[model samples]
Target: MHRLFKNALGLRKCRAFAHDESGALIIFTLYILMAMIMIGGLAVDIMMAEERRARIQFTIDGATLSAADLQQTLEACDIMEGQFRSAGFANVHVNHTRNGAQYESCGVAEPDADIAVDVASVEGIGYRRVEAEASIRVPTLFMHWVGIDYMDLPVSGAAEERITDIEISLVVDVSGSMGNPSTSGETKIFELRKAAKEFFTAVVKNDPDDDSAITSVSIVPYYHTVHVGEDLLDQLNANGGTVSVQNPITNPPGLTSVQSEQQFSSCIEFTPNDFKSTAITPSQKLTRKAHFAYGSSSTRFPNYLQFECQEDRFDTRYAANSRPHIMVHRTEKSQLDAHIDTLTASGNTAIDVGMKWGVALLDPAIQPAVKTLADDTTIPVPSRVNDRPANYWVPSVSANPQDETLKVIVLMTDGVNTTQYGQTTENQYPYINFKNSPAPVWRFKNWSTHEGKRHDRWSVNRNMEWYDQYLIYVPGNSWSNRWYRPGDPNTSWDDQWYSTSEIPWDGIAQMDWVDLLDDFHVDYMAEFFWDEAERYYHSYYGWSTREDPMEDKLKASMITQTNWWQANTNLSEICAAARAKGILIYAIGFEVNTGEGPMRDCATEGDAYYFDVSGREISTAFAAIANHINQLRLVQ
Candidate 1:
């Protein structure tokens, strides 16, 4: 009975143990926890791998960009390695163009593809697609029991950059206003000088990497007029042959025009619709001639180029002074620096001429000085792979259509639009004192009116001293006034009998060229008729101001004011054209007391285009523009 009972108990116990729920739930829970731990470890590893990938990619991008810089003298490989190591990356194998054109690296990335956009260009301009692959083994904390010792993470990254070629035309205002004090208490011109020098230094960096491209700079200095070089002046039709400009008179055969027998310095003159355009498109639409009817730089100018009578100047000033012209065509670092120092301030502010020349210089159609210095090492142009305008600005990379060249014109001014002097006539001669109190005594208002008349018809109203006194041969009247000043308008002139004592009565008949030449009469005309009629004796000869009428003629008679306000249209059009053609225009206005409205309109689009005010800000503006331009010179 006891054996039977013990067997039943043990069978029941075995059945209970087989169906037990408590311990089974505990075992199942333990197994699930172990699996969850393994999965969590994998998730941690993946998260770490993703973080590593981002970090490594950032490092690679930095390395690639730095290595592609034109100013970067360090090797690309070394740069990449250094960057990766700094980013806490170990055992990284980097490779690509070394000691060569590109800044590419990576042991397993495509080496030849997108090596660099233009690494040899200034400041890493183009896209240098850099790729980097990282292999990292993460030690697992919980997966070791499953025979997996570590997690293999492969992190790869790639990146690209682009920089274009830059061409800059720096136009500054050398007008009188630039000499004024600025906000920083310095001369605006001086600030401009400092700014310009800084700009040159910042842009024209002699980088070995920028071998394929260059940053070209040209300067255009201006005042009331921008004087072009002789090359452009020689190209004019007036300079060619048989030059004739319209005159005021119609008599004396060919007396109705001024002829250019002598070459003169080129001046900004008429264009389409009697306005100056920045587009100096060397076409024959409008004649490109300088205002050379008057050549004397002094206040007195011979009103006519060559006519019946020309005045002899007394104490001229500009006989030896070279006609002023701009100093920059091609910009070398040293030469640019020198030019910045030599800029002086003295002249009316003519922004129109300045802007015209500034934009005109950049136009490929016209660049004589630039062409001359394109081959010089001091001022290099763009890339010279093709024969087009040798060493001129062009795209660094030919294959990439997106790669374009950049051209810039920095136009700066300190004053408002003042009137420009214009000479619309030729025979504006006033050989006799224009408005002297004794003028018009002879009644010869126009020289051409007496072209074919007789001497008796012309009359002199006075007589005077004989030493420095003037004598006139009125056609058949003869050189000696021995006919007696009969019926004089002022009776005192007739009573001046002592004046006849020194008169050359006998020498009059001996005069051979006495066909009554008006030219000879004008050269020795007795001016100041009122005063001379009262004078009797004076031993030493003296020059009377009335004898030379050149000063009066040039003062207001020859120089006429033009509506320079019309120049705004030309200025805006030029800026628009340049901007349309991918050219950048920066217009800076310093102490623009009149208004910066025109200057603001002249600048290109965006804040980068316009800078109004002076002092350190001028330099700041220049530096900003330069940085932008320099960036263009870089190939990524």
Candidate 2:
């Protein structure tokens, strides 16, 4: 019975052992723990790879940015490589392609990973665009066991510095102050030339690889007034004056025939109303300013260089290339540079006039005149920029952004506005008897010892015998009966003569008032005529303002005077008008007083737009502005 019981127990035990699951549960736990470990490993590897990829992406972002900078002087790909080196990525390999060129790899033998960089740069007259793309192969750590080897981190960026379709009005002051030396011991004009030329080179870079240009610049050199060239006067249809003289000093003189005189001065007399707005109306009839100068006769007689109209100095009417006149939209660097070199400093400051012309060039109202000038050969305007001086940007209006223009004005001045002079509409001055038309002069010096006799008697008479000789006309009622006509008056010279016929002043060739004032100084002409009348006929004629003939003439000629205060008001108005139209203004006060406010108020509301520099700092200021325009910014 024990044996049988034992056998049953053993059988039961075997069955129990077969149903027990503790050891099997331990084995299953082992398998699950193994799988969990593998998964954990994978997660760790993926997270590490992601971190590495983020690092690579960060590096690439910096690299592409530096590479795409227009100011970056190094090769695009080279710049990218340097950026990587700077970022402590010396081991990472770089493969770069620029402008469709073949891919080139940096010498990184057996690098852990590779970064591919592609760059494309396009340069133009007023714009530069750079696009860069980068991708890094991040070798996976644990993921490779599962057939995943690497992850790609791609970063792309683009940068652009574009002032596309830009119109710039460079209103530079050529006032006499510009001739003074700056703190740097160089003439202000000399320094200005270098600075302005560099400014052009920076903004209007003519890339040798690209012939396209969308930038145009108009040069308006101003002094007391803006001198519109001869062509501009004709375009404006500004009319000149005519002078006529009747039989003068006669009993009830008769009116003589009138003759039209050419407009010698190219300056316009803008009324007080003209400064309230920025438009230079093409259809409006502009009165041509009379040519005259005001100063003492001693300092301004023969030279006549200080005339209100600078036509005598520049002679732009005769010389097409003469400067101090407006030079319309120019593109060529050579042409612009040459024009700047010709700038001469003379005349008082008239900041308002300068700003007026500067703003006018950018105004759309002046398009007709600009178009006409663009077709003209002397203007140096390129055909490609024929549609320049584009309309001001209005964001509310619907249009493509690329078509919008950026108008910039760089107004530079050294001094505040001074007294400006203009002429009257009426011919209130005396007619000048030119030297070409000689009048008869009779002189009778009586030596009391001898009988009453006339000496040194001379006049202008026609003589066929001796080319041309002076002859005195002695009328029948004179002390000596001498009928002198078409012959020399020397036949009656006996060192003794008497006063005879009154000088025939009616036969003299009368000069037009405009022509006379332009050719001769006001005080000089006044003195000449007054002295002639007093010395010859013992009489006086013409308008007298101060009882002094010279002073009267000077006052009559300079009828219009724009004081410094009025000019400042006009400048401020024009500047505000320009800014309201979204036109950018950059004003420079070179070697000017600190208290000056008009120039400061004219600039766009920022220090970057206004430069009150002196000496060589002017160049630094100009360079800053140029750089601001060419400053790089990420587009994407």
Candidate 3:
């Protein structure tokens, strides 16, 4: 019985051990399942964080880019805020400061969630950067049974915007050719004017108000020369006038003899006292001839009559209007308008002169603005004589204090240099004369003293008949005279008497003279470009307000003017200088045939600033240039 009881106790202990082992196994299995759930939840949180990071990155990047293009700092901030919200980052908080670097953000989506982002170096870099962070509360799945409710998942990203500033210059052709009708039946000049005005308005409208903004524009108008009107005229007197008139044949008035008589009579009635009673001679009679023979094809009688009348009336009218009457040419509004109206195309082109004058006006060395009292007081003045002991010099009243702005020149020409006139030379003449020597004669008297002894008498006489002899005389000749006469010592009738005479006459002939040719003075060329640049710059900045006698702030670039039409070999140097000085040089080749020598030398490289436009396309080319300049400005 004792042995059996011991065996039973052993069996019971074994069963109890087995039961404890099973319970331990169950506990192990539960732990393993809980661990698996936790692992899965962590994986999901990681994925969510990564996806959020990507979304935030995309949103920040887009917003930063948009902000970078903004003209104002406030606008940039607004853009960032709006963009983040739109991207579903409603919980994101943004802080902007002018401390010149980095956009900072910090926020949480829930009590258990942590979210943070850093957009570093927002100002130190050329681009603007935005840092973003997103966080969410991730509830545990099976792990919830272990008393852990949720975990915080955070994602972060950064975005940046790239920015660049550009400078541009526009050169336009305003030559007479631009007035030609376009395919649209409007003058190229008209189209160009419209387009240019639009472009100017648009660019000015969109330009950034920030002082450190990136873009600026300049307009240059050139024909055979450019006309910058009053500003340049006031600064350098560089504005040139161009006069164009329709061909007589094309603009003839349709008037018959009766109509012509009527018109003439009416004109006579309105004529001033000085012009009244001018003789109407038959010389003014109109002959009936084929219009074609006169270089015309119009068959209308009125047209023919008008054509004839125009030819007769043009001279008188032109003479009266073109008389050099004005003295100290003024450049006021009325004057400029009148000058423009008076511009008649009748003189040789002088592109160099025009360009020169234009550049002079914009030369900072010549015309700078005067400083105001405020600026003068704020900025320290440099000592003029440092060698001397320091003393109060009444602050040498601020010379021109205008800002040193960019310079530009636009050069254009219709034709190359031609012959110049108004010069003088010397004149000379030659002549000749001859003289004759006297002859002697003897006579005997036979009579009277026959009674006394042989009487003898002697008489002498001479004739001067060689004075009219012909002799060819050459003034500059050294060789010989065609008609040379040798004088004789012995001659008729003289009683041992020597006869001699002086010849005072000499042949005279005119000498040939040579006059030096006048050099092709292209004064208009330089003046045109300089004036255009100055005028445009001034217009862009508004005119100067000081009364200081400084150089014109709107002068053309002298360096550019001197080299504008130089050889191609020097083009790179010329363009380089212009670019360095922040000057945009625009060149137009009008009716050019010299392989673009001048145009290429004058224009910027890559054809970005040069145009070789035909006469009819000049306006179009100018419009295109203005449009390009407009594009450089910020767009709202």
Name the candidate that leads on TM-score.
2
Q: For candidate 3, write residues 1-636 as lDDT tens digits.
A: 999999999999999887775468788999898788788876775676557667766666666555554343644456656777797766555545434644344332233323333333344333344443445455555445657677565544444433323222233444445555655576545555554444444333222243232333323333322333222222221221232221211111211111111111101111112112212222222211111111123221222222111123234422431211111111122322232333333333334333332333333322221111112333221111111111111224423111123244555554453322211110110100000100010111221223334223211122222211211121222232211221221332221211112111222111111000000011221122222222222322333333421123221111112223332223344444444444556666655555565556656563777676654566566566555543322211
In the range 558-629, model 1's lDDT, one tens digit per residue, is 345545576666566667666665567888877676668778887777455888765688888888877666
TM-score of 2: 0.64
Higher-TM-score candidate among 1 and 2? Answer: 2
- Full ranking by lDDT: 2, 1, 3
The predictions' CA RMSDs to the true structure, in order, are 12.4, 12.4, 27.2
User: What's the C-alpha lDDT at position 120 in model 1?
Assistant: 26
Number of the top candidate by lDDT?
Answer: 2
CA RMSD (A), model 2? 12.4
Greater lDDT among 2 and 3 belongs to: 2
Q: Which candidate order results from sorting by TM-score in descending order? A: 2, 1, 3
| Candidate 3 lDDT for residue 82 | 77
TM-score of each model, in listed order: 0.57, 0.64, 0.35
Decoy 1 TM-score against native: 0.57
Weakest ten-residue segment in model 3 by summed lDDT: 512-521
345-385: candidate 2 lDDT, tens digit per residue: 87788888888888988988877777777787775556555
